[model samples]
Target: MQQCYGSIIRRQQHLIRCLSTKMQSFSMSGLEVDAVSVLRSLAPALDPNKHKGQAGKIAVLGGCREYTGAPYFTAISALKIGADLSHVICTKDAAPVIKSYSPELIVHPLLEESYNVRDEDKQSISTRVLAEVDKWLERFDCLVIGPGLGRDPFLLDCVSEIMKHARRSNVPMVIDGDGLFLVTNCLELVSGYPLAVLTPNINEYKRLVQKVLNCDVNDQDGPQQLLSLANSIGGVTILRKGHSDYISDGKEVKSVSIYGSPRRCGGQGDILSGSVAVFLAWARQLASKGEHNTNPAMLGCIAGSALMRKAASVAFEDKKRSTLTTDIIECLGRSLEDICPVH
Candidate 1:
């Protein structure tokens, strides 16, 4: 009877251990990070002596005749999220429209589509485009690519060159929307660059797996797959956006699953990309100060995901079903204050 009782207790202990491991794995599978703490750590402290542009200088590299709203949302969001200077590099047709969206952004009309240039002018045009972007590239702390980028072959070709230049300068980049489409086809642009971050939505995540791993996405082993994809891409960080955002840097996987709204509205991704850029800049600064050895991309993704979810939740509370991207953008400052409290 004593032997049988001891056996039963041992089995129960084993069962409890298994349950605990499974629960941990499930939590790590989604947006599961110490997001509030990360946000507080990444946010720069207020200082009276800091100069202008000391906070961050961010660039948005997308805008076409058809899609101006995306770049505008991205650039403006960076400013709202505490970036000091925001710039937009876009085609001549897109420059004026994007400029009209706000006087705050430094809008550059540099990019040209194939339809507008003669075949003989292609070489010169490409050279000029590179020159224009090169003059401003090194000054930027981070660049957000592919917001409203259309699928024009000529335009994408120029953007390909721009990506190479950004990689050469070792400047950090956050790729999203059409940017993912471009990088998915040509993996070499960001392959092996630690500062590069790719933020992909559900469909974008599926396509990335098919392109890089040559297989379908496995939700059951999502974290492992995300780690593999980041590893396969030469250590570039990936933030797989979904019901919960999963982030990986080829080293470890983390998730940030707090404060979300069920609205599923469009343009939220743009807000996230913009917010990520600012936090990434801050994280890099903190890393430079030797505060922590954490991956800046990973920290940026966690904070950005958490902040966007918080703002969305706040917006939804007020407007409920009517909450739009603009409404959420309006809540970013308040949300950040709630979490980190500047004063």
Candidate 2:
């Protein structure tokens, strides 16, 4: 009985700390949002009666010969974040390797790179790829674009078509890594889609600013610039990842400056993309049911940024200098549980 009382005290203390963090974040930037509260509200309770794919079905449209880990990371992260189903659509060379990483993923080796396809076969192959993706596109609650996607012109062309189809079907997408690269060149792919979320790091954000704003990244006017960028792209939400993630959906700008690990490990962005996808799907469902009136994409980005930062902080507490991306990922469940307990 005493131990149980102690556990209750500890939990209460943790809750207080979480609230304090939110207050602190709010003070930092007037635009800072309460990420912990957002996370709790967006994360649905686990229901025993929920059927497969009811919670969420996430598909990652990335992976190529030179890159497989990114897609695997994104797909698995979706599963780890409580998505009912996770799929990876990658090149044949990447499919086997991504499959080797985890059996939890449904790997589809349908994408073809330039070297593997002849000039004469491009049109037919592109059509086939789109048709194959079309079969599974509507079923997914969200699609995470980019990750390990190589910047192969041929592969990107196929993915562009896939994006178009996904848009037609009204599927939300979290674009990151190489996916941002593709969108940077062709802004129209996700330009007006409010359901689309772009997670861009320093370099990716720079390119996007240059392309869309026709100028450089101004630190002094960061928030306004982000607002303009999102507005210029037709109000698609943009999550500018950095020390403090700045999110904008054109209407307003919100910042998530939650504490995170200092270790700059690779693949963390992939986790963010996957996390955002899952949360975006949940938020969208809630919106559809009239549970919340806020923009799902904005809520998704806020929750995802908070969760990823908290997870990284937890992993760093344990591993410190040795903390890797996988370590941060392993802490995701615990971090989320702390913020929004399953019970």
Candidate 3:
């Protein structure tokens, strides 16, 4: 009992310090955020009295037969970054492979691809998929809606239904990978939902701009263009990933130019998605407690961008040219510790 009380006290003290630290952090026209400080403030304290799922419960809604590594990277990275529980809901063909990657994840083989289902079965199968996801829909703090998610029409349709359910449940989502592909074509999936965050790389961002604003990518007025996209989508946050990460939730924009590695690896974006989901969950908790007034989605993006970049930088420093996505994942814990040490 004494230990438990001590842990609570320590947790409260940590948050107090985090709050004080945030007040001192600097920004310029809100164009840049103090990402390191925001990360520290958003990350909850390590408390012994906290039980399982108290830290966070994250779900990754992706993984397919052709691409298992991306989901594995996303789920495991969430676990490594301090989420208490991480789950993957994927097609049956990909579930075993993702499960084999790590026993830490609770893998659900619930989704169906077009190839496996008949036209008559698709309607029934999609209903089953949504039902299965709904069983645990409200349990997750956030859903990462794409990491190995392929562009199968049937699969994407089911995912679209799942998104509607999650939004109805008020569950936050970090969308990336082919999930962007789905949202690009069907803007209504995330159109007016404030809890949705779209993390887009160059190509994805280009497509989104073209689809939404009816124009090409504007590097000259990138910040304003990003703001316009977010506003047009009804305040859903967008994290435009590049040499420098830019984030906006229609109301405001922020940038993180922290130095990351030059290793243009395929799976780094997966790490960002998972990291953003976890941090977004934490940020939401902080907001619910009235600890911070900033938008949790915006805060989550800033912190995730900073931490991912820092981890990539550390991994590159150690492995240089040989740095793989796994190497960057390995660095998440240490990089976060460097920013916000456990008390």
lDDT of each: 0.93, 0.94, 0.93
Better structure of 1 and 3 per lDDT: 3
Off by over 4 Å in 2: 1-27
| Model 1: ten consecutive residues of lowest lDDT | 24-33
Give the per-residue lDDT digits (tens) of candidate 2, residues 1-343: 9999999999999999999888765656698899999999999888888888899999999999999989988898899989999999999989999999998999999999999999999999999988999999999999999999999999999999999999999999999999999999999999999999999999999999999999999997799999999999999999999989999999999999887878998999999999999999999999999999999999999999999999999999999999988998899899989999988
For model 1, residues 240-334, the per-residue Cα lDDT tens digits are 98787889998889888788999988899999999999999999999999996899999998898899999999999999999999999999999
lDDT for predicted candidate 2 compared with the true structure: 0.94
Winner on lDDT (2 vs 3) = 2
Clashing pairs in 1: 31-255, 31-256, 31-257, 32-255, 32-256
Which one is best on lDDT? Answer: 2
What number of clashing residue pairs does each candidate have, in the order they appear? 5, 0, 0
Please give the lDDT score at residue 148 for candidate 3: 95
Task: Provide TM-scores for the models.
Answer: 0.92, 0.92, 0.91
Q: Give me the runs in candidate 3 sitting further than 4 Å from their true place.
A: 1-30
Please, what are the lDDT tens digits per residue for candidate 3 over residues 1-343? 9999999999999999987677534433357778899999999988889899999999999998788999899999999999999999999999999999899999999998999999999888988888889999999999999899998999999999999999999999999999999999999999999899999999999999999999999987798999999999999999999988999999888999876888998999999999999999999998999998999999999999999999999999999999999999999999999999997
